[model samples]
Target: MSAENELLLIMERISDLTATDAEIAQFNAWCDGFKAQEIQVENFDAVSERVLLQVHRRINKKPNVFLPLYMKLGAAVAVAVFIFSVWFFSSRVKSIEEIRYAADIAPGRTGATLTLGSGKKVNIGLATAGDLAMESGVKISKNASGDIIYTIMPDNKVTADAVNTLETSRGQQTQVQLPDGSRIFLNAASSLTYPASFANKKERRISLSGEGYFEIAKDKAHPFIVDTRGQELKVLGTHFNINAYSTEAVSKTTLLEGSIVVSTATSQQILTPGTELINNGSSLQVKQVDTELAIAWKNNLFLFDNEELGTIMRQVERWYDVEVIFVDGISKERFGGGVSRFDSVSKLLKSLQATGKVQFQIKGRKIYVTK
Candidate 1:
């Protein structure tokens, strides 16, 4: 018989005693055979009517089988629909929770060590930001802003050699000024290492860990190079920011004024005003972006654009030094717009919870996530 007729016959026997396991298996085999057919069966109404007729016929023939067969078919149909719905919804809900979980552990804030010229190490977080004299003839002073500035005078030279290193714990942010009249703003859990003096005539260099925004001094004769996480940014004199946090997948360099060159081991690209470069270790993509969004963190704002909850939490974890745990299956919610970083963690959570999709609880320095 034709496939349609066979289906109708099976449907008719669905509630009858003759509709045994072997008969059901035969129907299943027929369905499997036609599974690869490309033709669309456009007569669903007819199929439904035929199925109902088959069920009624079976009920009249074998009343004992009517309830069990109907229940079994109903259960099978319900389970199929449930599985399909779950798959559809899951695909639509990107793995945003996984992203948030990764961001939570990603290292943006935390601890750091300062190594003096004498090879002595000082844990800056434990020590007060006051004048701490080192054996290397250097005096270290930590300002209230959490900057570690050094003053060193060569025993023979009249000019003092001053160096400044700014570092923040995993949940902290800080700013510093270089001896060369340049300024730097560091994001949470970041560090900058610079010399007391740019005595080198050809090139001046500094190393960075995490993220920093720089307003470099205008000295065309001496270029500034920022080294971080396998990438180097060279500038004659420009204002720019570098986000090379080890936890991030891409090292981003955004230029605000003048021009700069970003180079990795595999590629090099030059950037001009209003341009940003994202280096993914193996590839580089240059794009034009709003400078304000790139440097918003320095201005104490959290900007997002259809960003997942996981990404938003990473930023929070860094600035507030809090641990986040998700108790719910994993939030697939995406958030947009911006918020002030100056607000407390609870306030931020409340705003997010306002969406009615998720909730948060703060305990000590840890945040628990629920949905």
Candidate 2:
């Protein structure tokens, strides 16, 4: 790795945490290099090269973009020195809490609302353990830890008509154990609708909106179906993630463990492990993608692989329940790295600001972006 790139990685990895043994050794080695005046911070992560085109025009991305935080500091005086001090000081410290602004926002939490077919809305965050309600031949309740669970009832009036919806708003997320035993992790501003029981159903089908990671239960006789937006996915049993947020410019369906067939109005394509099917309005496109990045939210991490700023902000807006306004219009810089999603919003923004091209101003619930 280039010395500059290594410094970029070292700076970010040190900010949020205590490093591992290998990381400590790496940090020590960098310190040795700096003693010999070898720490030239120019062109950090290739930031000296400018990216001024619209991000959408460059949808085809690099296969692997693991560069850490970036910043430009070429004799620009203040910006570089001040940011370098922060990065260097933070790196030396064992652990420093995230830098806080005059006003800061917290990360999204685990919570959602359950809407019965009868229109009854039960707030999962405010709910207690025990059975909330019974429908069709199933009982819905929360465990001792307040996790949602579905149990088959003795008189399971298993019918296709008993449907329920689990929805999450901004700043909240949720997971549900479907009647068929499939588990789905729903992201912020997303919802999943499924039947109460699948005892007599021909197929285990669910409707989704926004983004979700699905671990489908296998039943050769009953194929699992996930219908979202204008596309449909069919899989006997598999693990996959679907990003169909309406605000996003494209819909991504990535398979991790099994096979799935995604069907649109005009064409149908089958996706195997490590492949993604993208529906970008007019046509469906398939590509080899990093599956982990596709489901990073499900794993409590924000992984960006040369992703556009607009795309990154949409995720931030959904998770923190804030508005991202680009006063100078959207930036075209591509972000590449990974960070814990549970940290305070400023930490994330700081990482982004390290890119040196973009800056952020947080006012109340709004984040004003500038270049």
Q: How many backbone clashes does candidate 1 have?
A: 8
Model 1 sits at a Cα RMSD from the real structure of 14.6
Q: Any residue pairs clashing in model 2, and if so which?
A: 70-354, 137-156, 137-157
lDDT of 1 by residue, 277-333 (tens): 988888999999888878989888888777689878877878887777888755779
Encode model 2's per-residue lDDT on 214-272: one tens digit a residue. Answer: 99989999999999989999999999999999988889999999899999899999998
lDDT of 2: 0.77
Q: After superposition, which runs of candidate 2 have C-alpha atoms over 4 Å from their true positions?
A: 1-100
Candidate 1 accuracy as lDDT = 0.66
Each model's lDDT: 0.66, 0.77
